[model samples]
Target: MQKVDAVPKTNKSYTVLISLIVALGGFLLGFDSAVISGAVKGITVYFEMTDSMLGFAVGCVIFGAMAGNLLAGPLADLFGRKKILIIVAAFFTISATWSAMATGYTEFIIARIIGGIGIGGAILIAPIYIAEIAPPKLRGSLVSFNQLNIVIGISVAYFSNYFLVNLEGESWRWMLGVEAIPAAIYFLSLWVVPKSPRWLILKLNNVTSAQKTLSKIGGAEYAEVTISEIQRGIAKKEEKGKISDLFKNKYATIMIIALGIAFFQQITGINAIFYYAPTIFEQAGGSTDSSFLQAIVVGLTNLVFTLVAIWLIDKLGRKPLLLIGTSFMTIALLMAAMAFNNATYNFNDDTLNKISDTEIKIALADLNGSSFDSQAALFSEIEPKLNQEQFLDFKRNQITNFIQINATLVLMAILLYVASFAISLGPVMWALISEIFPSRIKGIAISVVGFFNSLVSFSVTQVFPWELSNLGPTMTFAIYALLSFCAILFVYKFVIETKGRTLEEVEELLTRK
Candidate 1:
């Protein structure tokens, strides 16, 4: 396996610039995926929905993502990566604007699904584009730029939602609409970046065009060497790529790693935390404003640690990071479970004394010292006792003051969970997915695993409200903790190290029985 040394200084800036342009797609992906965290309560209230309906509306984007991931590979293979990425940006813009103006739940779900399509496409294509074009010495860090932009986007969405959380009843609309600005920038930025040199060489069979694009990526010497390597790789896999090729014995190990990474990444409930951060905090006895503020903290922690992952990915290797991150994730999730498990809610003089707000005290005046097993139980028992407005007022303040669990402990646990995910699985998973397959089948292989990824994400996000309603926070997080435990073992025993290896070398090494 050859290492990518520093390219000629002249092409360094050019390589980084193009990589950043493509990475904007990741920004929109993060913003669209997470902006909903702050909007879910508003959407549920505005639409008068059941928990199931709320979950469906929240998870609808995954359906679109499923469709987009299913098609992105073939489409990028046929039409070129850059063109499809441009179209994905357009979809994001349309989804954002339409979602903001949506009049009903149905319309909002449709808009979210549209945005999901853009997210799915961008998630697959951006990393592929970066991996194909980046110098190997910097490939891990450069490709990680997509993940970095994603965390930045998530952080910005959290900030935006928090800033707009107090905008009366219209705050959710503002959160959804702000995505359009970045989407348009991503669409326009495509004009400046060159096409994937490998895509041009193999798919287009236009070496002259490929060489020109590669030249812009590095220098003429870098272009020649890269072209030779790509040509040799293509020659070895002369038989054309098909969906079936991925199932062959030689490709089995890579397939397992790809699909396993995709599954563990989502099934461990990362999206559950990201998509429902505010709701989780609110359920754990916090005000809506406080929930949104805590979500901002989660976003910032994600941003900072993702940068740490980028700094360490090439230096430390992929398998070690996955093992380390998942281990910490297990510990963090157990901490969250314990925090929720020990929490007790009792409406009493002691609880009353904790309340400093007048409206809350007045609303709960007759019910001091009454104990309920969960917030859901508490709400159900009290709903018929007061008017709707009074019920809501009491509930908000009750949540703010009732829980015996330490709020800071819950917040720290969640922050730890996000940090664990950011530095290991978050960026490393995508880097491995992009690097493991043969060039010819890379698109289709990633598509299959990516589709599976979206499906799991959809299922988890869709069922979360129900999980909270039925299992309670302690059990919901307990299940996630168990899954994280499994993921750590899976990484330790089966996942291989792909840190410094080239794509061709990884493919060759993994293909051996």
Candidate 2:
């Protein structure tokens, strides 16, 4: 298990400090992932790409994250957790510099993918490290530090992106390059924290070193009990972890729980909102500035609600939070769909008057008197009237002129959806994955489940741009709404409450069946 056993109240400060340092990795994960939201428009314009290509560019990092997830577990198990985190920090630094300096589309994709590797490694290892080091009494809160940092990072990214949006052609570069500062800090900070005591004891059989580390974590008595527990736990293990060992019938129940939670988290379209927040706002009749401002609000809402989740997670238990959050998510998504469902775009006299830009006004001369039932229809009507250059500019600014809907309702729905997600699946998935699996196969099990999680994230992010153009907002969000409803049922029926339980106890309870 990643977390230490029960410790005295006095020494718990050390545990919190180390957990905070490792959790910085999650901050980088959030910053790197969401910074792309602001850059989407600029990158598309700079790369001169089509909808499918834009989707590929946006989602490519998740593909790299998938690879990183596959490798992080075994590597962390083999090498030490601290060393792997240092390596991940280096990856983040290099990826930031390389991506900012990229001159071509291919180079940009490669750089983002590299950063994604760091994101994946950091995402899994930090939580595992926190779990390993934290005492059982504080395990839930400490492990959630990773998620807290993630949302904090996302909030910072949104604020950064919002402020940097005025930089015109170079804003995306600045937004991405800022990550190097935190990456360097995280890298240098790793030296101060000790390696995982569990790793030293179980993998290296260095009980002396483990004892010292555990003593630092808790106290002498606490260390003695924890070490004894570790020894007893290891004695029951049949062998070292194998890939096939994860699927043995004894482990199947826990495996299903891990895989299901991972799958459900991404399929609910959370990343689509995160990766494309500004774009979503723009599609709902917001200006570039308002979109960026609204993105900041979303970020703040996420940050605030994540704190709420951290406070309540151990108190309410995992299954209750899942049930509550998914229920809210379902309602919020339907609210989003309903908001978009009533939208209509038309080139009436009022809309025509709103087009102050001379070039855009001239471009829309032929369609001045036309009315469109939807944004898609308006876009289709305008598509044939302009050249590629004019088409790009037109697409960017069209919603400002003709959209007729309650834009505030859409924003509120999205914020509600984000708030619900932040308090539940956003942080809970990582916590649950770290908790549910048996220690023997924990590393590989997390890697496999994380791989599938990134895979789904990749698909959702990559297709979101296309989905916006083809399926439209109403249909796209309606699908997510339905899925959210199903997720509530899945959690209520299949998921077990795991708060306040030790990793060993949870493993035994779940797998005994």
Candidate 3:
């Protein structure tokens, strides 16, 4: 390897600026994800959705993301990273506008899926571009800029939802539409950032242009060394990696670690918590206003703890963080399950009075003063009294008023869970994925695992509404808690420490028999 310290210090500030601008895509991805939580109730009412339809509406974004994950790398390879990013920004802008304006369920879903495509592309490409341009010392931090932006976007979406929740007549439209402002900004901003220098060298064999872009990022000497390395890496791979290559015997360990981390990351219910935070709080007997407010707290807690994770990840190492995070995640989920388990529902006069719907109020009048130990039991008692629509309305809209439980404990448990996730699986999983794959198989391996990750995310989000409706919150949380425990054991046995090692060193360590 060649050293390039002879020139003046590299233009680190310029490099940081480029990374931040590229990372703005992450902001849109996060905003698109969480903003829908506030819209869930409104859309359900407007669309007249059943449990399954509601789940599809909310989880459809990940469906589109699956397609994006498969296509983005190939598309970027054909054109350039910058162009695909511009296209992603365009998708976000269109999705936000179309979704807000959509009057039909099909139209609204189509719009949301468009944004999901942007999410799939942005989440994968932004970090790749940042890593390609950043100096080795700054690479990890610069790539992390995307993850940090994601949490910031999540917090901002929560605040945006709260402020718009009180708007009259379809405030959900405002919540979903406001994302266009940032999307447009990101679209225009892409024009300023250069194409990936490595792409220029590898695809076009335009060393001069690659060096020019790299020179602006660092300096002439830095560009020279970087170009040589990129070319050498490309030369060593006589054939590009294919999807079939990932199944080979030597890559078995890599596949196991990558796919396992990807599976556990979503199956443990982080997205379920984030995408449905307001709804979860509402289930614990909170008012709509309080639920939205508490969701903002969840987002803020996630943001703070994510910062903590970044600071401690290299210091604590990857496997330890996964072990610690998954363990605490299991405990926090159990705490939530226990809290919901201890809850009892009583429909007193005061609770009945809180029901605004006249039919629902009258229907539940007979059940006043009757108490039930579990949601399933209470729902069963009420199931025969009302018709299908009435029962659905009672369950979705009116049940919150009749619950008597420790709201504080549920809130605390959720906050702890979010904190634990942010510090461990949230960032650590992506970091480890990037480290474990050999450079030859890195692109395809990431795509395969990323697609699987989206598939799991879609399943969790899709089933959550149905779970809440059928199995009740306690059982739903218990299932997640069980999965979290499994995640801990998987990490302890299979995951290796990647801290302070070069990518080559980490690859060699993991690949060795």
Candidate 4:
């Protein structure tokens, strides 16, 4: 007879099989954020609306976010994580279906808010839940899956909007509604994924059920060790957090870091471009078709660069990536701001209506492989007319600007912003959220952090259109770029490295500090 080893199964396959459902929440979050880009155009047309209305319509999701995040922490802690997630899935399904069927702007806005709430929680919870459950060796990559799902969702939404926008009638509504499919999938996926053992033991005081779930994920031997670690955490946890507890200098710092990151992300003004890039391009000198095409490009670049961050986070480590990315993005934003500044003009009359002639010349140049020369010639000719003209033609410069710097360069800059975000703010902030909090109060802190993050999202999304309207693109972008630099500094000075550490170890380090 031979003794056999009883080490827990660490098969990538098993973990992945269970994780498939958990990641669905990420998918839903991404889909909901982007589906609005498509709806904004049709909704504006359908409702005979304008920029302010469209802006409100698009940003309304943050309202949902505010509510979702407010409730997500207490609910998760009170009922356990999986139960809250199941509730989130239901919200997604309902919101998506209703959004597609919305008759008026009010209906649509309400649905998006409802849907946004679900996404806000899922976005925050999915990664944390995944991180807490995975083996230490696989945590980063496994958690990165949450982000990967989000990108996929954004990508799909872009593609969906593209396909749906051309449909004969109310295509935008269809685009909004179609997301219900994934929402349903997410709800269904939750059926199989086990509850977080740590949540179960710590909050529910159910060590046995937690052990069984842990054993299923990691086998008996690993479950025993996992249970032991979770209990240690349970012992370390003080009275669950009070709002007053956050006032303590130590916890206050944690809350500030979280809120600071959230604020940094918003003030970067990425949402201005995201929610209104088409309009900005239109202002810059692009046609509806070109603007839509450019919007798709932005989404693709966002997805690809996010993938880049996911690949590199573990390899490059967090600090260097954040600092380097912030620098690159800031430069691009400045370049864009300058480009927009150069294109600024004050045409006074129906000149925009008359720019057909100029577009012809630009088109001829394009047809002849001399596009740049002709385009430059057109802009040089038009700039003075637009700058000087008062009432003869108010629109010529706007239309001409589209052909000049609108589509390509502006998109390049915005993509740079997204790239920076994907690498620095996008993934890293979430990583920090999962990392920096004390484990005892991690859920409450995370929820509060997410609440403030959503607040930032709400503020950015709500104010960007107004700011862009008043401040103009160049100034708006420059300001955002500057804010991003400040964010880079914030992290470099105050934040600590959490990569490659166990949750337990990270908590110990934080407390020791």
Candidate 5:
């Protein structure tokens, strides 16, 4: 192994092309996560789901992702990253097709869970692959391509939902099944990209193949240097990392940072917003069409700001972005909380006419021209007037007609919150996780933290609808606001800057802390 005086110039176009193809998995993951938002109304009606049931249907994908997170790393290590990614693509294709055609509740859930498995694998594996292949100079930006594709997928899903919303019967089916075309394309695209060079060297001891792949990414000299580094890193490790190794005292800081970022990322309500964007807007008195449009705006904001993050991540460093992003996220959430807090539900004659259910319309006639200060107050006055089914229907569908809110303010707040997240937690967490771990424990540690991240995402998505119904939007947004504030403090106290540092340099720096 020879020591190199300078970092080799990489074959930039080649590295980027491979990264873009692999990151397509992130696009699929994003699409699968968000397409369901458009389908929510249809599925709730089609399945005749209660609040809890609706939550389960929406959150089940995360449940499947948990299984994927657990399985993806070990399988990638045993088989190879490229092969597992192909399997992930197949899972997405199957899940999309099956979920679209599913007529029964149980069947729909099964289909979604299968897709969730793909989501789990794609979300973890794509960045890991990108990180492994990328030069340190380009690592942050290239790895962020996964996050960029995610936001693009999300934006596309919103547009797809809006376009397909009027498709005769079972419009949700079209919205969901449309994903199959892209998923199949992704499956085929995986065939062209090379396996992770690190995986080739580490798992199969195929130095020649690894060098060939690396040579394509950089040059022969770059390949030689990188291979030497990988070999040296491997030589220093006595054994492969076990699950127990993550709990060691020396790794405590890494574990804390990983777990905290994982926890805050989801717990701050990003997924809940992504999964239920239209619903949140609708709660603020938006019409269905307007809500969908606003959701698209949210997606676009996310996409644009994610691009900004990519540009700044390697420039401004991770901690500053987290600090700045979390501060704005807190403020935006507070804006939303205040907007919802000041909202009033008023049932006038015009508002009553919007209720399609005649029985419920007549039942609510007595409350005509009356206004309530809050959703809880409004629900109290209306609950005893109707039976359980009617009440649920009114809450889900009709309440939007009567609410008087600052719709523009709510929209602005949501967009700001999303933009803040896009620049900060959304891409940075995965980037940090990929960079900070020791090579020995990296795979298992990521899986553990990813599983935790998915678990938090599931809980937030699962309980969101219930919170809107029970705690009301004001309290729900306020809770997120508080969490966002706490996130800022955590980053300030714990997270270290990792800008422009090699993975080995980052590990050494953090290990000393």
Candidate 6:
């Protein structure tokens, strides 16, 4: 029999250092997920493709992520977190190199999907890896380093995209190729980090090595009792349970909660803003040349606010941030509606077209009004209905204006959403996941959550563009904002707070009737 202590005595600084290596996976995840912004427009121009194809090219990574996240748990369970981190980092490095070299639309799409595998693996692994070693008091903050890295990665990608695209040649290729440096750094760090002790004891059945790793993760005084308690938890599970037990009522509630957390994170449509940011900015009445610059601003906002989230989560805890963030998001969504309404209604007026046709004419020279009138006459003479080209041009202008207003609104919403996510859906979800599972089922359950989360991410990423284009941006975002509202319902009624609770303490709470 082993005693389960209330907490582990780990040196916080050393433990966080190790977790940061795993968190590097997050940096790659953010970069790969977002770097598509720089390439979307240039890729379209280079390949001479359509919007639908462009969406597919960008969204295919989410599809690949579905499979990667599904595999993350089992692989991490079997191989240990350190080994898997190395593998994911390698996948990213290769994918980056290949993506940069891709010549055609199909090749680029394939490369993006491949990169998504790394993204999925990184997200699933980082939290699990960090949770395995983190002390309860520090766990939330430490795991959140993953989100912090994610924002940094997004900002870096944005900056890199801007700088690289300035080169005289194909700038998108350079935008993608830079990810390899970070991936390589992540891989090198894993060599020195110790494997998760809990993983060794429970999954590998190696007590001595587990104790050795635990002694370093926590101090020796801490590791002795902590390691004993961890094994006891595993032993208790071995005596009384099976994987199917997770489907029963006690565990089922937690599973539903975990799934909801995953779904709402994506349903907020944050990724949509990230994915189509430049395009959204372009629609907002900006030139193609300026869209990337706006994207950089969005990325910077994401980074700055993410740090705000990291600082706030441990202090204020998770739920409050979520409440504040979602409320902000809802208001932002309404404002977006207002912006799009302006764009949708203001399309194709003859007055606007007359203003654009004066190429070299003086600003004070109002004589060119007749030139648009003549062109309008010729267009009407040919078809008699509203001229298709002029109507499309008008719609484009309106869309640009609409996009501009909505995008500005979206940026504010995204900032709030990012802050909220950094605290709640971002870090707390993973903490709760680790907390809910009994030690015996931790590996499998983490994998299951990872699978479902990744799959939801894939579905949301793929469906949002079509929904936005067909249903209109206002409707699409409104639907996502609505989902966030529904998520509030789920959390209020069912969620259990896990902050500052020990592994045993959290598990016992789950068992309560």
List TM-scores for all candidates, in order.
Answer: 0.93, 0.95, 0.95, 0.86, 0.98, 0.86
Between prediction 2 and prediction 5, the one with superior lDDT is 5
Off by over 4 Å in 2: 1-6, 353-366, 376-396
Which is superior by TM-score, 1 or 2?
2
User: In candidate 3, how many Å is residue 443 off?
Assistant: 3.0
Worst 10 residues of 3 by lDDT: 1-10
Task: In angstroms, give how far residue 260 of model 5 lies from its true place.
Answer: 0.5
Candidate 1's error at 439, in angstroms? 1.0
Score candidate 3 by lDDT: 0.87
Candidate 4: stretches off by over 4 Å: 1-10, 344-351, 354-403
What does the lDDT come to for candidate 1?
0.87
What digit string (tens of lDDT, one per residue) describes model 1 on residues 1-513?
Answer: 334566777888888898999999999999998999888878877887777788888889988999999999989988889999999999999999999999998888899999999989999999999999888778899899999999999999999999998897678999999999999988999977777889998887889988997787677888888888898998887666899998888888888888988999999999899899998898788877889899999999999999999999999988888988999999999999998888877887777777665665666678875877665677687677667656654554356577777778899999999999998889999999998888989889888889999999999999988887667788899999999999998898789987777777787899874
Better of 3 and 4 by lDDT: 3
**How well is each residue in 225-332 modelled by candidate 4, as lDDT tens digits?**
877877877787668876666667666556767788777767777666666656666767776677677777777887888888878877776677778777887888
TM-score of 4: 0.86
Give per-residue CA lDDT, model 3, range 136-240, as digits (tens): 556656677787788889999999999999999999999999999999999999999988897788778899899998888778778888788777767767876
- As for lDDT, the candidate ahead, 2 or 4, is 2
Cα lDDT of model 5 by residue, 224-334, tens digit: 988988888788889888899998888999999999999999999999999999999999888889889988999999999999999999889899999999999999999
How much lDDT does candidate 6 score? Answer: 0.70
The total number of steric clashes, by the backbone 3 Å criterion, in model 5 comes to 0
What stretches of model 5 exceed 4 Å from their correct place?
1-10
